[model samples]
Target: MKRFVGLISGGKDSFYTIELLKQKEYNLVALVYIKSTDIDSYMYQTVGHEMIPFYRQVLDVPIYIIETNRKAINTDKEYVHTLNDEVEVIYDHLYELQKKAVFECVSVGAIKSYYQYNRIKSVCDRLNLSVLTPLFNLDQRVIYDAIIECMDVVIVKVACTNLGKEIVGKNLNVISGMRVDNWCGEGGEYETAVLDAPFFKKKLRIKNYEVLHHPEEEDKERTVFFMKINEIEVLEK
Candidate 1:
């Protein structure tokens, strides 16, 4: 049996990657996630502390949450520096997992960003692990639709400035049309959580959320609404 490890961030791309892998019937070894040590180094989809538990329960798989302080060395380099640091941190963790000697493939939820995808690919090459991207080069809208149609998704955080207070706790279907285009939440307008996807045996029911807004820098000029998760429940059907 071929074994694979998935790098999940609990976002659209990562979640979609997992879905595609399940379709291929690869033996999933573990879900690897990086817990941000501080907000300063939190560049990639590293949201708040909610990710650790959320993914564990949702994936229903063994999770390796590594704590790393890796950050971008250059303000000018953007994703290159930051993504390279992340790949290093992930490779180190995977090396530790390799002691068990089960996983030979590392699947990622990368799309469009060759800088991000190629770094992981290079590391996988060095580690002698096959790197697979289930969502590579696909249209962003198709990815979003797949998540909504096939999974129970919710917006846990809206990172963009234009979403305002209207988005927190709202379902994807409710926040469609003018809101998505104007704000571009799918294009980094916000971040989301897969409360329940098709892969799950049960769906997650959430309650007691409050919408709050924050103003971005003068140049961005948009306000983002943070959805504070007060209570969550997993429902059985």
Candidate 2:
């Protein structure tokens, strides 16, 4: 089995990709989280990363934490530079992980973001690390339903005016009744965290949280609301 380090964002696609890798008998050595302090990070998931600790507990894999330094950019050159910066931290941690044993590849949840796929492939090429995107090119509805059947996820952030603030902090199932503009949730429409999944020994029980409204962005036609995680409990299966 090939050894790998998965990039986790506490989101459905990332977790679902990891689950698929696990089924394929990959040696998941560690999880890498490229934490972004910016709520509006372009290269990575910014919200719901606070649940990473819970994710580690569920997966029983060591986590390598890295901070993202790139600011959001629009130009192709600046965007490429920023992506390289993001990959640098992940690559640095992969190097550290390799001291314990040889790691063959890095895993991600890239589906349709050509920009993300290209940037990741570019860095992995330089690092001699194989880039695995299990969810690549899969149908959006398939991806959405696959996640629903595999885990218990929660909406931690709703970035679209189409989705109300009430949707945040609710389970992924809550989307069932809504008219989803994007079932994939890949376009920054919303952000989620896997509270429980098939591989998890226990599920996360979210007790309390504070909803923060990002009205400025809403006025600007962007992410409207986010949740601040305050309390969590682990429920044994």
Candidate 3:
């Protein structure tokens, strides 16, 4: 089996991508994640990242949480296809992993963002590591159906006008699976937290959490809400 490092977020798409690779017999030796202190990352998800520790506990794998926060850079709205200062940090983490053990690939969960996908690929290209994006440009409905069938997930953030606070902390099915307008919460419309996945040893039961909307002072055309994970308990299937 080929050993590869998977870049994971506590989100539906990333978890699904990891499991899909596992099903194909990829040896996922370690999980890589970025602790983005800044919220506006052009390539990574920043919302509801607090649950990463819980995900680590369930997967029982060595996780390297690299600090990839670059506040001064990436202020431009114009998206670039090349790796900027932020991706260099990610490349450093993967390089360390390669030194520890030989790995051929780094998996990502890009779905429609060409900027994100290309940036990750370009960064991996520098390290001679292959970039695997299993969810690239797939139909959101198909991705949604596949994710719900295997992973137990909840919405932790909603950034679009179509989503509301009521949808947060509920199952992904809370948003109708057939709804094409905002399915899979792709393109920053919303974000998900994976409580349970097939690779997980136990399922996550949300014991307590609070849904908080973005402050009114920073309000935009649409309201955004995030679920603050107060507590989670693991259980057997």
The most accurate candidate by lDDT is 2
Stretches off by above 4 angstroms in model 3 are: 72-84, 177-179, 216-222
Q: State the lDDT of candidate 1 residue by residue for 1-237, as single tens digits.
A: 678988877665676787788888888878887776554343356553464565566556798877777774434423332454645787677888899758879888777666567767766876889998877787777777777788766676766545555766667665666446522253566777767777776666666776655434446554656665677766774
TM-score of 1: 0.82
Model 2 TM-score relative to the real fold: 0.90
Q: How does model 3 fare in lDDT?
A: 0.78
Residues 110-198 of candidate 3: C-alpha lDDT, one tens digit per residue: 88877667767767887898888888989988899888888888888888766777888889887874344747766677888888889
Clashing pairs in 1: 161-222, 161-223, 185-189
Ranking by TM-score: 3, 2, 1
TM-score for each candidate, following the candidate numbering? 0.82, 0.90, 0.90
Q: What is candidate 2's lDDT per residue for 91-170, written digit by digit as tens?
A: 56666677875778888888888777776776677678999998898898888988898788899888776788899999
Scored against the true structure, residue 210 in model 1 reaches a CA lDDT of 68
In angstroms, the error of model 3 at 230 is 1.1
- Each candidate's clash count: 3, 1, 0
Ten contiguous residues with the weakest lDDT in model 1: 73-82
Off by over 4 Å in 2: 72-84, 215-223
**lDDT per model, in order?**
0.67, 0.79, 0.78
